[model samples]
Structure formats: C-alpha cells, structure tokens
Target: MKQFVFLIDTGNETSEHKIHATGMTDALKRVQDLKNHLNDNSNSDLKIKFKGIIYENAF
Candidate 1:
C-alpha cells in the first residue's frame, strides 16, 4: 500500500486526508468514496485541490 495526502477545498473550508491504497486507481476510488461520504453528510460542495502519493513502503 501507499500513503497519499489529499487536499479537499470546499469554498469555505479546507481539509486533508491521509489515505492508503495500492495504486492510482485505488487512490481515486478512495477519493470518490470520501466525496460520497462528505456529500452525504456535509452541505458544502467540496473540490479536490491536490491529490498525490506522499510515501510508499520499502517492501
């Protein structure tokens, strides 16, 4: 798995997420999942500013 730093900017607020995924595809899936969760619970419209893998295990 890899570690990712995701920056979500909602017009009014900004948040960061540390995610673990195997690859880019999975990382995107995780972001979508997070978007869905936020949409379901929050009222603001959030947008992703930066999404990239920060670190990977040396295994």
Candidate 2:
C-alpha cells in the first residue's frame, strides 16, 4: 500500500506559495492522484491509504 503524508503549516514562513494557493482539499486530491499513480505500477498488490492528519496551530 502507498501511504501519503501531508504536513500543512498555516504559518510556515518558509512555505511554498502553491500550498497556500491550492489549500488542503486540493492538496489531498493530489495525494489521491499520487496514490493511484503508485498503485498502478506497484507490484505489492496493496491498497492506498491516508494515515492520520495531525493539525497544530492552524491559522
């Protein structure tokens, strides 16, 4: 299985501008796409999953 992890920082001074522009929903969608991309080529025959989301000090 492919595990996707997204660490979002609302106030990450050094964060990329795209993060703020795309927001979480769109980002997670990209993650789903990534999982699908990996699943298509992997030989493990496992399911794709999103672990836990840890949020702190969300702006």
Candidate 3:
C-alpha cells in the first residue's frame, strides 16, 4: 500500500494548515472537490491551496 499526506493551507492573515493522509486513489482525487466545497461555504477573504501529496515509504 502507498500513503499520501495532503497539506492544506488557508492562506490568510493568520495562516493555518491541516494534514490528511490516505491510501485510496479515489480519496486522493476527492481532495480538490472537498476543498472547493469548503471554499464556497466560507465567507473568509482567503483562498486555500491544496498542496500536492507526499509519498512516504516504498510499497
């Protein structure tokens, strides 16, 4: 199995980030959709960057 870490940053005056990890191919692609959904709901004047995944260890 492979692993991935998604570093999400909501660029703002107060920069914040969260990490999510998964091994599923479908889940990895869903990050973009989820991020978009979140952006639409938030009233914040900021945009979040969906940083690419980081592979950890060999299969």
Candidate 4:
C-alpha cells in the first residue's frame, strides 16, 4: 500500500489528512469522497479548499 497526503486549507488554517491505498486511482477516489463529506457537513459560511495530494516517497 501507499500513503497519500491531502492538504485542506480553510483560509485561516491548514490541516493535513493521510489516506492509505493501493494506488493513485484508489487514493483519488478516497480524496473525492473526503471532499464531498466535508462539503456536506460544513456550514454554509465555511469554504473548504483542497491544496493538493502528496504521494509518500515520491520525492
């Protein structure tokens, strides 16, 4: 398995989330699900931005 890191930026603060998957395709699906989940549960005044995904060991 591989590790995928996602940066969530909400103007004032930034947060990191890690997802473990078999490949990029699976990782991306999980990321999208995360975005949808956040959007669904967040307040109308709050905005969520996804900076990008970092692949572990890609460097």
Q: Evaluate model 1: give its lDDT.
A: 0.82
| Residue-by-residue lDDT tens digits, candidate 2, 1-59 | 22224432223221222222134576567755655675576544434333344344455
Worst 10 residues of 1 by lDDT: 50-59
The CA lDDT at 44 in model 4 is 38
Residue lDDT tens for model 1, 1-59: 68877899878888899888888788889889989998998788888855667666565
RMSD after CA superposition, every candidate: 1.9, 11.6, 4.5, 3.7
Q: How do all the candidates rank in terms of lDDT, highest first?
A: 1, 4, 3, 2
Model 4 CA lDDT for position 40: 88
lDDT of each: 0.82, 0.43, 0.54, 0.70
TM-score of each: 0.79, 0.40, 0.39, 0.67
Clashing pairs in 2: none
lDDT of 2: 0.43
Identify the superior model by TM-score, candidate 1 or candidate 3. 1
- Worst 10-residue lDDT window, candidate 3: 12-21
Instruction: Report lDDT (Cα) of residue 26, candidate 1.
Output: 85
Residue-by-residue lDDT tens digits, candidate 4, 1-59: 57777777655667788888887799779978887887687753334444455556776
* Per-residue lDDT of 36 in model 3: 75
What does the lDDT read for residue 1 in candidate 4?
59
